[model samples]
Target: MLTLASKLKRDDGGKAGRASGASDSTHRVSIRDRLLTKEVSELEAHLPSTCKASFPDEDKLHHFRLAVSPDEGYYQSGRFQFEIDVPEAYNMVPPKVRCLTRIWHPNITENGEICLSLLREHSIDGTGWAPTRTLKVHHLH
Candidate 1:
């Protein structure tokens, strides 16, 4: 009963609706995927071979852990753990990294927050971070 143009409109509407839903889902997944992939790669490259890091959940890459066993120095023979929380912006912004292991270090605060130049995302002037500076996990300690 419907004309060709009307039938095409109906079909296009259904297709557009389905496509819109799929696009939204894909966008959300990609955000998490991109963050996790980038974080895992960066950790693997920067972390010492002795240390191990991974994302337990493929969907939730924002949370991860690292195990560090110092070969020498005051922390020698001690196994330390760290938790990393990467924000949505990630590489463009600094991630929140903290030591899960209780260690007494001049750079680390009693509350587990690291007081390092690179870990700080904001400048002393209260302005946003510089675009060129990409801080790494090792810089925290």
Candidate 2:
């Protein structure tokens, strides 16, 4: 269990291991970027009917406006707008979500700040944000 070559390969003995580790991190970043692209593509291809997202400017991909309309509820036929700012490290980190609508609710403040526990950074489920749960947990119905 103690060969020079084996130790070097394991990253505890030399430069080659360090280089390998750096490249592995780079590879992971690449994969995350690609996965995000795929998720965006999926969002584009299959958007929910009750909600829609629109960009404020054509050049920016990180910022957008999302609109939601509930068909049958106290807010039936009411359109609520929200602004979503997707961070660079999304999926691992949650996007910033704001109400952007003037409404009174326990979860939403009049100033457009949202109080949803799932959307906040202190969530009990895995350090506050899980990209996979964002879309599913935002249902108004």
Candidate 3:
């Protein structure tokens, strides 16, 4: 004999203090966010001396910037910057990376399109992105 609204309320823990609502305390963490928490820590632990990573928004680990200054290379005097964005599909797909600083590299185009084999989703040489690949900052070069 209960109304539709009453039934919904009863089913939703009406005054029983149950966690059936989407409250802030019950915020769900996605797989991507969970993986970034671990990967970001590992990245810091093994960061190279010539490379630096900075998160503009500490809460947003999915987006970050990288600075690279080679000590002994053709671009030794130049410090290059790159933007790395980890999509929601993380391990299933490669991170979208682009060069923020203009450079004339064979692997990178002038418009910031990267040409790394591992970044490719489908590569004929069997070097395309795979789920096993981690966010290894060292492999950026």
Candidate 4:
């Protein structure tokens, strides 16, 4: 859940608190964090009107909740919540997404498992996850 910005801030704090024994490993930022920093901005830019994203902890961009208020359809005017977690190996792997609200949807299970093709790690049809795909794929406008 750590972002590059937070990591940098933490590193700065560590310097002021302790000068020695701070290894380079402690400063290493994950690829997921760097990707989220950019992808998150893109997500906000083109976010659909029916959808809204919230990060409970502003410093953790990799973890957030997405609220979907469908304007039309069987679930029109109803709000659905989803939690997304981008793992450390992101881009190389798909972000983990789970439906927080209990709903009867074909693509989403009651237990929060999602069946989106892009969420899959492998697929014979080539619709599975790819490094090029970003967080924006979850909210197809």
Q: Which candidate is the best by TM-score?
A: 4
For candidate 3, the per-residue lDDT at 86 reads 91
lDDT of 2 at 141: 24
Which ranges in model 2 have alpha carbons more than 4 Å from their true place? 1-33, 124-127, 131-141
C-alpha-based local distance difference test score of model 4: 0.82
Q: Rate the local accuracy (lDDT) of all candidates.
A: 0.62, 0.61, 0.76, 0.82
lDDT (Cα, 0-100) at 60 in candidate 3: 72
Candidate 2 CA-lDDT value: 0.61
- Candidate 3 wrongly placed segments (more than 4 Å): 1-26, 137-140
Ranked candidates (lDDT, high to low): 4, 3, 1, 2
Top lDDT hit: 4
TM-score of 3: 0.79
TM-score of each: 0.65, 0.63, 0.79, 0.81
Write model 4 residue lDDT over 1-141, tens digit each, in one string.
Answer: 224456567757866655576565555557787688778878877888988889988777888999999999999989999999988888888889999999998988879899887898898789999888888977882
Superposed by TM-score, candidate 1 places the C-alpha of residue 44 at a distance from the truth, in angstroms, of: 1.8
> Candidate 3 — worst ten consecutive residues by lDDT sum?
1-10
Residue pairs of candidate 2 with colliding backbone atoms: none
Backbone collision tally, model 3: 0
What would the TM-score be for candidate 4 when compared with the true structure?
0.81
lDDT of 3 by residue, 25-96 (tens): 444556887787777777766777888888887767789888888888698878989898999988898899
